[model samples]
Target chain A: MDINILLVDDEADFVETMVKRFGIRKMPIDSAKSGQEALTSLAAKDYDVIILDVRMPGMDGLETLKLIRARAPLTEVIMLTGHASLEAGMQGMNMGAYDYVLKPADFDDLLDKVRKAFERKQLNAKARKQGA
Target chain B: MPRPANRAPEPASDPHGDPKGILARATGARLWKDHSLLLWAHFLVPPVLAALVVAATFATPILAGILAAIVLGIAAVSARGLLSRLSQTEEARLALNTQLIQSQKLAAIGELSAGIAHEINNPIAIIAQEAEWAAHLIGEAEKGCSADFAEVKDSLREVRAQVDRCKNITHKLLDFARKREPVLQDVDVVRIIEDMARLVDKEASYKNVTLVRSLPQDLPKLRTDAPLLRQVVLNLMTNALHAVDTGGRIEVSALADDEALEICIKDNGCGIAPENIDKIFNPFFTTKPPGQGTGLGLSMCHTLVDGMKGKISVASKPGQGAAFTVRLPRRV
Candidate 1:
């Protein structure tokens, strides 16, 4: 599946490392430092999956998810929580999120989830098209 | 607040180093203690006098009786006022002491965890980066070289995995040390478990571990912090995975009655030692080797469960594996 991804987090070093690693894998990736920046990027481009940090400074991951669902219903959202609280993940899922992943996650594991989420989104789009 | 002009001059050096200031402060403290004791005795005297006057009224004349009545009335009012004020001050002092102790514990935990994270994570990050760089360079060189690089590649992979493991422990250490305000909500326990299982199922399979989940279909929804509860369960489940060898069985079962909902994670792995069982939940106390665990997982789990007004306990015997049970109040 062709997936365009956006990573939103306040941790610059983590983001840089992830972006470079994913770049080596030839995955299409973009990043933002804050929720506001994430929203701006979301408006500027169409991404299949948005990996959002739950503990950002302003407009946290949940709030950003709300705007994403409102603006682009077809776009899937994956929450990333640094701490091991599944509550944040569940909250995100309840708020119409695609899924959630823990931080410091294995890259292969994360990539597998991202691919599955993108495929799910693509299937939904195809269904909508067929219905129309 | 400025010191009085007649008061002794402030010490220019440490109290221990300045003999005169130390002596003066000690004397002043002792005098203040004596004064407070006298004041407390003064408050107690009125109540005693009131009781004595009431007892003596039976042996006195009519005029003396009237005088005793007035004295008793004034004493009663003063005694009541003093006792209430004294109790209030005592309560305030107790509360301040409790708060002081709590803050001290939190401060110490914060400092220790921060120190561990800083001291360990920086080195871990560098090691991981250097390993990745070396692997990259080796990959490039392998394109032209005819010699076997299989062992070199396998060693580099092992190094990277160890670095990642160190990173995970440091991250968990910071998680345990940092205080969090859990946002509570009405939660479906079943859903939370499913989510946690989804996250761990891959690893369970990779380890050849069998995960058996048993929950009643009629289980009621729980009213508590979902994330905290999920964390506690996940930690227990992960610990169970580690305790058992490949092909071992781990059962996660949930049951609820009238009082509380209980979730148990039981594994048929190498059971905890008799001496180590009691210390399992203590921070930095691990049975695992040095590089394998930071020993923060169970402690953090304990903290999270306690924060939710829940209880966590364990039962185990050598050669019988272990069982961790978490009890959460069933509000809804």
Candidate 2:
């Protein structure tokens, strides 16, 4: 029931609104204002899921996913997009985002995708430990 | 607004460059420059030759007459040749001009369609949704009256169909003008037609243009891009729709013949001028206002038809409106 999550997005309103929504749903969460802040958070702490938005100005979603995969290879990042752009979604997937959701998104789908990502990350961790 | 009587500047200066200019010039030029010189040369040359051939013939009076006859024959042949050359040159120029105009129209249509699709997409969706809600309320209220429900359903379907038609027409207009390959497939004509109808249904409705269709029982299919054919049908129907006045009827029908299937869109709008009839298929010719029409619709249709080894023709009378015929080779 306890799921640690990092939400990184430049749109303060969207980030705050989603934070409130997740709080109501009782999901453990940390919020970051930018990609660098998200990286710093990951370095300092651990999270099960990272929800990122695609169209951030300087450090966009794809770049964030790249850095996240490099730094926290085990953690899963889900891309949240504003417009349903086919190109951005494919790029996000290619860059190793767990799953992509369109904005004004279905919260249930977001939850389902995050839950699967968490389960996958756990399996990956166990596999690494056994290999070690 | 009063129509400007002299919008074209006395119709001269560029008189040498209308689509009909070459033909007019060849036939209408004041005098043949070479004719006078040739006439004088003929009179002089024949006498010298005749004198050389026969001193007796030269002395006879018919030599001068013979030379004059020869000059007349030459002029007739030269005039014939000039007329033929003028027509050919005009046709060639027209073909080039058509391609240019068609390309421009396609570009403009694409830009407009994409913009309209994005801008009006929300409103169209909302209108459709609101229309749905009204339809629903009617259904609910009239459940007790079976006849009322039946009538309501029928009318709502009409409204729904109309909305979708506008959507299709606009989308088709846009895509036709965009001129991209747009990924072809073995598209079902029914769906494409419905899509186009929906796009333009709103426009048609506002214009008081009634759309009536007679699709074939089982029309032949084609291996073509959906977007492209949608463009072709869209252009024809939109043109026909615009031509017709409010309360006028537009008959859009699709049929099949040997190795070919066709769509003929007929409108009860003001028809083409007899002089402009043939020129309509040429480039940059439109009955619509300058900004309203790029005059590429028919040309694009021709280019598309030609590409498919198909053909398009128009039948019209001055006051009776026009019918556009589109025939495409049936794909096996």
Candidate 3:
């Protein structure tokens, strides 16, 4: 698979490292510094999965998630947060994020979740097609 | 799995058997297994004793009378036993019927509330927007007016806040009512639980509560809807955190068997009262004072677990603590 992935975070260093890590795996990933920018990117291209940082400067992850879901209902979102805030995690999952991973997440674990999320998107798409 | 619409109908092996006939056969098999001896005695003993009674009547009246009395006594005893057994079965069926009716009522109420929530949401949104617009107009007028409109702005802010509160309740109601089909995927059960537990770690620490995880290392991966499971675990953990007092303890554990995977959240806190236990999972059922809780968390958990073809239950003793268990099938 050719998976279209987007990484949204405000931290420059975190975004840079993720881009490089995914690049080494032969998977080119898009990056966004804020939720607004993520929405812009989403409008331009259809993405299968999104790795979103919870705490951001402009639009928070949960708010961004609501919009992303509205814009692209099939896209899967995985929330990443630096701090373990119980409230945000609850809200994120309730709002339809695929999974929630804390900062310092194991690279392999994150990759596994991403793959699973992509698989769900494919299944959902196929299901919708059949339903239609 | 293949779509139901595309699948072929199953073949019935018996050419003469329709669906009803197959059902009757199944019931008959079960009845035979359970009461075969009773049936044999009931059919055979009566005829055999009647023949002996007739023979005795032909020979002597006294012996025939004795035999007839014995037969009558046995029949009376068996009739009494069967009557008691039938009454017991009737009582059990009545209880089950009540339960079924209660659940059906709950489902109907759930649907009605969801419809009300949906119909109310738009007006709530409009109210919030009008509040905002009114505040803006007041702000624009305040600039040109000589008098202070401070109190008016304050009231507008209050209206907006109250509107937001209504919005929150309606949104939760909508969530409770939404029919989300579970999307199955390969899920690492341990990883998902650990991730959600980490989210609760900081809050747990603040309350001096220890969140112990006893997840087994050999637990199997589950095929389930990942986010729905995540929501259930997170809500339950959060509920536990609220239940515990300072320096309290909460334990999160996961167990897997061949058939199902079980995750439990146990808390040492004020347990539910016996009177309130049955009402806990009902929507809008809350023990917390007004404005403290919306009471949708556990009910939402119930709804989500049901969507995933799983079961959720609670066991609690007042003054001791409470434990909630969520059991998911190995494959949904």
Candidate 4:
């Protein structure tokens, strides 16, 4: 699968590490350190999946997801957070996020979610193309 | 992270028009029900007796005088004792209520700290994983007989060790917030100090500060919580870093005597002020600007050390830097 993923978080070290790890796996991945940067990256290129952190300085994950869906409805978003708040998770889902994952998440689980989200995105794109 | 943007305005939903009016109305009702007769008699009795005395003085002077004295004596003594005792009891209840409020506040703070710890753990995990990956790469490079292999290996080891320290900090913060009991074990202060020195070496150099270690070879292992002890040392080291500027020096030394082990962190930077010395270990007391410090570092250190039956002290003056010494009992 040709998966283009965008990882958004405030932690630079985490972004660098994940970028390197994804690179080693031969995946095309990009990183943004804040929500504004993430939105800019989203506008510039088409991504199959976005892994976004919920808590950020400005333009939180939920807000960014809202704008992304409006701008590029085909893109799938998987929310990530260190602290687990059920209300936040539910609100993110309500706001059209594909799924929510907690921090220090098992690599296998996160990869599973990302792959599923990408597959869903591809399906939606194909459906839209057929409709056109 | 961010302060509350806007507070929602409260609504006026009181059934009663005003709180004070409601209180007064309730008090008035109770007063009328409980003591209306006594209150009315209190005012009427003296005047009625005086009128009786004046009228009876013309008839029987002895009877009127005795009646007046008895009524005055009973009114004076009865209410005085009851009022004083009631006020004393109220005062005691108020003090107990204040104490209850304080404990509740502490409990709330504990829960907040736990939430913060969870947030911090994610970044620590990332840093740790990155360090691990770097270590793997370094191990591979070492196989190629690289000239800089030794230095790279040492630096990677330091990074990994410090990441572990960061992990411990998050764990300890959660445990402390949950009020969990510490797990005691034999901890070597020498090794702890060495790891901490390595951890802060990069930061120290970045600020052009000299880092020194002075652990003697003959120190004994101390019994305590390893992570908590590491946290204390880490907090002290980080504080020392902020206390100094360029060309400043920090020395970490450990010594063991017959009964206890002493680890001292000395710095040649800006020392704490005399007034702040006493409040240095207080929660939320910080000299650094908002967002720079949580102000919990030293207070948490103080709590952990005290939990281990240890003592931590500081000695310093303005412009002369400070030294923090932690004394823990030595274990065989």
Per TM-score, the best of the predicted structures is 3
Error of model 3, residue A55, in angstroms = 0.7
Please report the TM-score between candidate 2 and the true structure.
Answer: 0.36
lDDT of 3 by residue, B240-303 (tens): 9999999999999999888899999999999999998877888888888999998889988987
- Please give the DockQ score of every candidate, comma-separated: 0.05, 0.02, 0.87, 0.01
B59-86, model 4: which lDDT tens digit per residue? 8879878877876775576568447645
Ranking by lDDT: 3, 1, 4, 2
lDDT of 1 at B59: 67
Can you write out model 1's per-residue Cα lDDT over B119-192, one digit (the tens) per residue?
A: 78878999989988998988999899787778998999999998888776675565455544344455678767
* Model 4 pairs whose backbones collide: none
Candidate 2 chain B minimal-lDDT segment of 10 residues = B6-15
Q: Ranking under TM-score, best-scoring first? A: 3, 1, 4, 2
Q: Second chain only: TM-score per model? A: 0.53, 0.46, 0.77, 0.49
Task: Name the runs in model 3 displaced over 4 angstroms.
Answer: B1-46, B49-95
Maximum-lDDT candidate: 3
Over A1-132, each residue of candidate 4 has an lDDT whose tens digit, in order, gives: 689899999988888888888888788699998889988898899988999999998888888887887788778888898766544553465455766677776677678778867766776677668768
Chain A alone, TM-score per model: 0.95, 0.93, 0.99, 0.96
lDDT of 3 by residue, A20-66 (tens): 99999999999999999999999999999999999998789999999
Residues B121-233, model 2: lDDT tens digits? 56777878988998888877876664547776787788888778666555334333332222334556765565456545656777777888777657766665443466677
